[model samples]
Target chain A: MRLKMDFMGLSLKNPVMVAAGPWSRNPETIMRSLDAGASAVVTETIAMEVRQNVRPWIYSKNEGYQNVRLYSDHALEQWLIFIRQIKKEGGTVIASIMAHSPSEMAYIAKSVYKAGADAIELGLSIPHGEGVAVMGSDPDHMYNSVKRVIQSVDIPVMVKFSPHVTNISELAKVVEKAGASGISAIDTVRSIIGVDLETSKPLLATYGGYSGVPIKPIGLATVASIAQSVKIPVCGIGGISNWSDGLEYMMLGASTIQIGSAIMTLGSEVISDVIEGMDKWLEQKRLRAEGIVGKALSNLKSFDEIEILPYKAVLKDACPESSCETCVVGCLVGALEKKNGNIVYHQELCNGCGLCVSLCKDQNFELKWRL
Target chain B: MNIRDVAQRAGVSVATVSRVLNHPDQVTPKTRERILEIMKAMDYTPNWFARGLNLNRTGVIALLIPNIMNPIYTEIAKGVEEVAHNKGYYTLLCNSEDSKEKEAAYIEMLLHRKVDGLIFIAGHLDPDLMTRIEETRLPAVMIGKIEGNWQFSAVYTDYFEGARKATAHLIENGYSGIAHITGNLRFIESAEKLNGYREALKNADIQINPKWIIGGEETIEGGYLAAKRLVRNPNPPEAIFIANDWMAFGAIDAIKTEGFRIPEDIAVVGFDNNRMSGLVEPKLTTVNLPVYKMGLTASRLLFDEMDTLSSTSESDEKADQKQQIFLPLTIKVRNSCGHQDRIKAIFGE
Candidate 1:
């Protein structure tokens, strides 16, 4: 199985990698993750000064991870000291930096590159409750920062974007025009981490960045939209729990998948699991892993161009024991039903949401278009 | 004799006899022959009034809406069409786009064309337009809320009740420090929605922080910008009740961009449960207004007024004065408010 892939101008053994965060905050943890089978390891986002973090930094809200603060506590000098060491150890190192000024970003980018970092990813976006004062969400700020960093660094430089903007594709286009080699998106969703009723205080004491399995759809959408609009390689960095999750990102035009909360919850062993699962799935499909990247792009269309056929979900007879109850609930248009010993679909009620078709993993439901 | 009396004597459908006189080719040869013989014997003639080609009325109604691209107005247009189709009237659909000049132009054009009646949802009631209507005594029914003292028939949803219910739902869900992003305060509907938001907060004993209330554009971008500003405050709102769902989308995305958790950090409720409300990420909790019914009722009322005008020349009467009709509202529970967290917890998605 040929799992090796090309990201921007660099060769990667696989598409699965760990993003910059607490998981990659230290040199030892970075080495451990690289040894655990990550194709590349991005350093924790280093800045000009230390960022204060409150206790209980991360909260696992059901299936989502709400993080109060992000970015590394150490400065650029600490990362420069070990980026060379990590590279000498034959592990791919991508320096992630978040700086306030364009010159500061360029200065950090040059130092990290001189320190033998294989790549540089400018941390342009910060999730809510996390920004000690970084500029990553705005397009003009992102373009200026990315431009200076790319001009300063000889190696491939990627820019990470936050999904907070109304149009991610527009920002992606601006970054591409500003000379970014690659784009990593959906840093984290800015979200409230719930509040304590008794004390009337936020559970995290402030708003935070939300990530995990629930954010995969947002990541997929942003990546797919950007990939179609621009020619640059996109590294999807939102929610990647396992191999199949990574595969979904690849199918949606991401050249690589950034594993974050999943590693924190499931440990570094997840990196190997993802690689092995990808190999098996690639063999099973009789295709290479790279072949699936951006395969779903051609079918993508804008909201207005999507051909909304007056189609309705209809139940077809299958085994009675089949427990794939995808069409039984969450019908926003009120189209489906779980009738006595069978699935019933109301043709008149279905608003062509196609939720049932996407959810029915067992192919028990069929959409009949009314011409 | 009238076409109906001729049809009874001819033992044929009234349509057959009328078709024989107005359109000879439409009726079959046998039906046409029998209808002609009966018409000749009974000396029957078609009734121009019943055919809705009344000598005095154009039998046309103009429907002026803010934006035809918007689904809300289109849904209402559907209702207006159904009533117009049944009443033997043709409809002229106009897109005003919330522009006073464009709306006035449409009104002037409809008047020049001598349209029998008009059913329109105005962003604001123009005094000049009202004066023209009063001078011409043209039958018009205003859709949605109207604030001015203009004496015109109107059919609108009780926006106050809807906005209040939406705010109450958020407060009941433990969301305090609520902020509201309403449409321009100049519109009567916007004012009513604002009143409801303030009333709900007052009932909950929460101080009305003047800073929390933002006069926003009626567009999605307007809501997004408003939500962004609200998030930048020293102490941001715990939840936001937007004037409508389109704005709710902007607010939700803005809040997400600002790194605040929804319902967890802040809950959000929007009015106007447009179809796409549920499809938006996190789903929008919104107030449901039956705009289609409002359009239907307004057109029906305009038809009544036009009928009275054509039958009797009563220019001014107490019973013929302008009337207002209010419809009920519902609060649709969805993800934004986090009110459905229980179900989300049970489902564990």
Candidate 2:
């Protein structure tokens, strides 16, 4: 069966999209991705005209990468133009906007919806130089920003979060509480590609947005955490270059996957290839893409939910009637002790955090699921 | 008991009581101990609002940068923060996104908050905003680029020289028909880089090809697109010098996709020497812009200005202004520019 995933109330033909960035800056790129088989295209973050050009270094060069600071001045007009073009081309467009203040974001969201965007993607996590240090990292700031935008716009609202924060689940809950309709798990993680040792300055704009296969694991971890934490549908993004990557996102609880840097490197043809490959994989697995959404999520457990076994009991169990007391000395948690000529467990004081699991040579000790 | 009651009990004025509480050493120890004992006896607490009103300083500094996505600004921010923290100052970092209006707003906000000083990473500073900054007489310093007759102190890398040296190195290596891929020329640094590119070509007696010079977005994708166009030409340049490392990576990717080997088919050099440059298969040879040092210098300048103003008598209206500081740049020889083997051979064990 063909996959049909739903985010909030919006329906998708499949769980594939083009995440916000340069990929969705204009109508032409949006149309290209749709033609290449993307279900939806999330627009770039629209900041206030004042916030658009915060620094010149924003225009600085990196290794070989360059991003034009094109989304400046008359952003509303540009958005309208792009939205109209996308609509004319029969593509679904999600207007992504970032604001200095909540009211401003809401105003932009309303205008974007009026301009014919299917949804408004509130970019709560854009790791711009000063923006990340100020607004991007704070949960309170993100919540208030989402709340203001949600109250201002009538259309469905989704917040794109940064994976750079410490707790994705907490941030997801904050956005949900603020009335966001859905969550797009992960904006680009803040990273410095490195400085030129010769010039002793940074390689790109001084600081470059890092994405690629290197960040896939972090994106997956954040998406999985957010999906399990909140009831809202999660749209996973970051380093999804192929169908397998897209499928992994779905299994990790993403209702949809967003393509960005991959398309930049591989071209729009990647969207079609990913979709075909995903469809083929689904058939082989006897499951639809939609079916995989939240599949692994049920099995996902929080760190606190893991039940760590008693170390002494585990060690003794592994070496039954043997005088190998190596595990007691190797134990860092002090949970293991020799009692009554045998290793004994003190479960009462054990926090069950599982720091002793790795120290043991035998696979006897395992975290049991607490009922 | 309130501060007023403590002042009355200690037989001292409210200002004296405040001075004792905030600047204990400024007051006599006998008087300070008397006030402290009275305050302790009465369990009196001083109001922060009133204290702020008297001090007229927030002990905060506003740091403005172009983009957070760029690690250079962030590293500069890290340096600024390090010195700011040492000086007991909190930094309010704002990303202007290279917009004059946003920078203006952030300046106003910081001023409204009564920040002690402002550290600005230069971009497009509107004339009106520059006028306002000058009129406000706020201690401000520019980092990364210097603009408009140096109204404020600035710490920047010598972009013109850095770019010139990089291009000269490439030219000396016998790379003819070198193409240049740079960011938007509207920026001062980009202009400097373009100038260096042209100067190197002129010095080498090689005719400049306008078609070879591609100005696109400063991104890997932009580099990829530019590389695609450059390489497809009937006679592409023997070597290409990209303005930034990010574009260089994209250009390399584009060249590889076209089944061309780096250095062998077409030598490439990028600026910024970003982290991924050395890690990449061929590695990247590029100019280094000392972001952290620039940030530290800018921040230190601001603090030094603030200190001078604070220490100067209120009657002395005229205060000495700090001058701009320009940091030097050096090129890192890496594999991407075909210097890997040469360097290794020279430094053989």
- Predicted complexes: DockQ each: 0.00, 0.01
**lDDT (C-alpha, whole model) for all candidates:** 0.78, 0.73
Writing each residue's lDDT as its tens digit, candidate 2 over B1-349 gives 5777887888889889877765443454457678888887887766656756766677678888877866667878987887676554679889988877788788788777778788876655665776778788889887766555657877667677878888887787778778999887877888889999898888888899999999867778988999999999998888888988888889999998998888888888888766677897787778876676567667767875786677657452246655545556667777776653453222211
TM-score of 1: 0.49
Across A139-203, the per-residue lDDT of candidate 2 in tens digits comes to 88788778876765677888887876777678888888989898886776666666689998765
| Residue lDDT tens for model 1, B230-348 | 99999898899998788888898999999998878988888878878989988777877667666666775686577566655565334465655555576767788878455322221
User: Where does model 2 sit among the CAPRI classes?
Assistant: incorrect
Regions of model 1 farther than 4 Å from truth: A129-134, A303-305, A308-310, A318-352, A356-363, A369-371, B1-349
Candidate 2 chain A weakest ten by summed lDDT: A59-68
TM-scores of the candidates are: 0.49, 0.43
Q: List, residue by residue over A1-371, the lDDT tens digit for candidate 1.
A: 36888998899999888898889987789999999999999988876445577688888877898887756876444566678678778999899987655755775677688778999998877755333333565778788888888877789999887777776778889999999999998788877768889999877756678899889899988888888879999999778888898898889899998898888889999999999999999988888878999998877777999776777776666526445455676788767666665666668877666787777766666778875
